[model samples]
Target: MQDILGHLQRLGMSGYEAKAYVALVAAGRPVNGYEVAKRSGVPRSTVYETLGKLVARGAAFEVRGAADATDYRPLPPEALLDRMRREFDGSVDALRDALPAVAGAPEGHLIHNLKDGGALLDRAEDVVAGARRGLVLSVWPQEMARLDGPVRAAAGRGAEVSVMAFGDLGDLGGPRGGERIYEHRYSAPEAVLADLGYRLLVVVGDRREAVVGGFGGDGSAWGIYTADPAVALMAAEYVRQDIALQILAERVGGDELNRLFATDPGLLRLLGRR
Candidate 1:
């Protein structure tokens, strides 16, 4: 009963309305205001008023009988939920059509924090979907699975899509035609997994916006999303440098590349391993 009330409340019902509706539905037959007050523990003084509001909201119907008697019946739960879904969808569509015309003001630079893995993934997908010219990303296999559709969709729409993947992407599947995929070779996937306890993901869209984050195996994740040009450019450059390093590594071979980094004092100091 409490669960039902909670759900009803979420659906925009007030406490008295939810309680009164629950009582009516439990009765499964026509119930007068007095019976609803007694069964739902709603105060007798306000039970009629609550039922009237429920009727106005289409959550209940009032049955008319002889002698001015009115008994109320709740709308079936399944029917009520279906109607709510339809109404919500209609409202969303209406707002989608109406909002853009009213919202003509330019948006300033903004940063948002996404504190869950699902939200991070959602923002990444949105960035990919909105890419007009190019998309660059750094991702691991696990998240790549979730983002494959939007990435492919962006590429299909003529955006240049480039990926710098952290782990083995042998079966990583989505890229086609002009898309570029580079594997990062600085550390083994196992070493990264052990060291970070999480996988880092970054996406930059059309050089305009970016999302950067880490998803942990322990079910905690966090990300920052921003449309600030400087931040977005920094993220884009970070991925660009990773791609450049991969190309250099291919030319010099991984062993020779590591040998140079180890030998060069400046490089060693930059890497903080001196």
Candidate 2:
């Protein structure tokens, strides 16, 4: 069965090891090296060397030995497979133990990779789907429209939902309307909105956070995620400041909103502008 022996060789067996095993199977007994080489078409010297390797590898072993004479046989297929599996599992365990060091090396780093719009949307959806506690989205009208259902579902599952969003999110089946929605409206003066619009959607979780910036423009968008406490705290503070400004804008009326918020100091500081 040269074909079968070749197949075994390809499956990580040494060439002579495969030949020796095949010869043992065909002979149906512990065979000597000369007969193994002759029948399996391996050279005599190579047969003995391969047999030694097989014995060390636990695939085949010598049952008896004398000067220039050794009776060798293959392990049962099941036993061979079991040992192979154990070897593979041991290798995997060793690699897993070394993972932190491997990942920690700075020789080559994986910098930020950009995905197309559709893929980026899928990433955002993944964050929304995994959200456990709540979602705080600072969104433009178009992006807000896309997220309405996800936010509703989050609220349905008892999430504390909040949106300080641009444009009217119009009665997105608010919690009172047989749906779960907690919403807050925030808009700058027309002149301010005309100049700079809210273009971000942020999803905040207890330990995970995803922020999408530059929503609904000429496709200038980027986002970041981090589990670091310091990073999350900074993000939360930025959202808080933006929401506070929006609340004050809504209360003060258009002219007053313009007069007070149009100033670079009030708007810039509140919106986390640097």
Candidate 3:
């Protein structure tokens, strides 16, 4: 019962209105305000107003009763659901048509934070889907699983897609023609994440948009999606640099570079050392 009320609230009903409508639905016949209050646990003082709101919203119909009293009958559940679906779809359709016309050039502060892991994933998906020409992505294995479908679809449509993946991919699949995947030198994602203090995510699309984020072990995540061209280019370059480093390390050898970094004063300072 509570779950049903929650659904109604999400669809734009106040708690009183949801309760009143549910009461009318369960009543089987038209129910007066007094009976609605009793059944729904709403106070009698506000029950009539709540019922009136339901009637106004077409969720309930007012029925004339004996001795100048009025009763309410709920719209059938099937009809209510149909109405809600139509309204929701229509609003979405209208927004799709209207928004792009009004959305002109990039405005101030084009960067926006995605507040959590779910939002982070959503923005990443949006960036991938919006890529027309080409995209460069560097991501960890766990998130790559969730994003591979869209990535493959984008590549299948002939958009150039390059992926620099951290950790074991284990036969990562994509459209055969335009997609390429590079494995990071650090085979385990945890090694890279531990060195960086958090898991890093970077997605740059068509050299125009970018998303950068960090994920933590406690299910907390933070990210930003940016439309600034300079920022986007910088992000793309970051991943490209990583790819370059990976290639160099693979071919040129890691041991000598490790020795250089450990012994060279300039390189040590560059690594944030004393």
Candidate 4:
């Protein structure tokens, strides 16, 4: 019952209206205002008013008998949901067609913090899907797995896609086929994970926007999404540097790369310890 009320509330029903509708739906027959008030625990004073609203919204209909009394029956759940879906889609289409011309232009530089992993990845996917020219990303396998489809779609549309993957790409579900779907470079995940104690993910799209975030061992995830050109440039450069280092590592070999890391105090400090 509580879950039904929650869903109804999300669909724009007031608490009283949701309660009244649920009561009617559960009754499975026409119910008078007083009976609805008793069954739904709504106040008698508001029961009729709330039912009237439900009828106005097309979620309920009034039934009149020989006497002057009125009763209400809720629309079937499936029918109600279908109606809501059609109305919602129509509103979205209308707004999509009308809004851009009337809406004021946006100001430069926007940044938003996404405090959940799902939201962060959703924004990342949107960024990738909207990319026109190119995308540079530094990601863990888990995030890459979630974003693979959007990334591939972008690349298929002629966007250049480059990926610097931490950990084994195979572990994160391996390579996605198709030309230029992923131009990838491998990096030891532990190299950064050991220092940060978390997994980092970054995406820069079309050199215009970026999202950078990390997931921690404690199951917390966070990200900053921004359209600030400077921030996007920095993120793009970070991925480029990682790609460059991978190239250098390939040329010098792993043993020589290890030696360089051992001898370089700056690089060692950056890695969190010597």
Q: Quote each prediction's TM-score.
A: 0.63, 0.46, 0.63, 0.68
2 against 4, candidate with superior TM-score:
4
lDDT of 4: 0.85
Point to the candidate with the largest TM-score. Answer: 4
Candidate RMSDs in Å, in order, are 5.8, 13.0, 5.8, 5.2
The lDDT for every candidate, in the order shown, is 0.90, 0.65, 0.87, 0.85
lDDT of 4 by residue, 136-156 (tens): 888888788898778778778
TM-score of 3: 0.63
Model 2 worst lDDT window (10 residues): 175-184
Of 3 and 4, the candidate ranking higher by lDDT:
3
Cα lDDT of model 1 by residue, 51-113, tens digit: 999999899999974578999999998899998889889988999999998986776788999
Q: Which stretches of candidate 2 lie over 4 Å from their true place?
A: 1-114, 171-198, 252-274
Q: State, as a TM-score between 0 and 1, how close model 4 is to the true structure.
A: 0.68
Candidate 3, residue 118: Cα displacement in angstroms equals 5.6
Q: Clashes in model 1: which pairs?
A: none
Best-matching candidate per lDDT = 1
As for TM-score, the candidate ahead, 1 or 4, is: 4
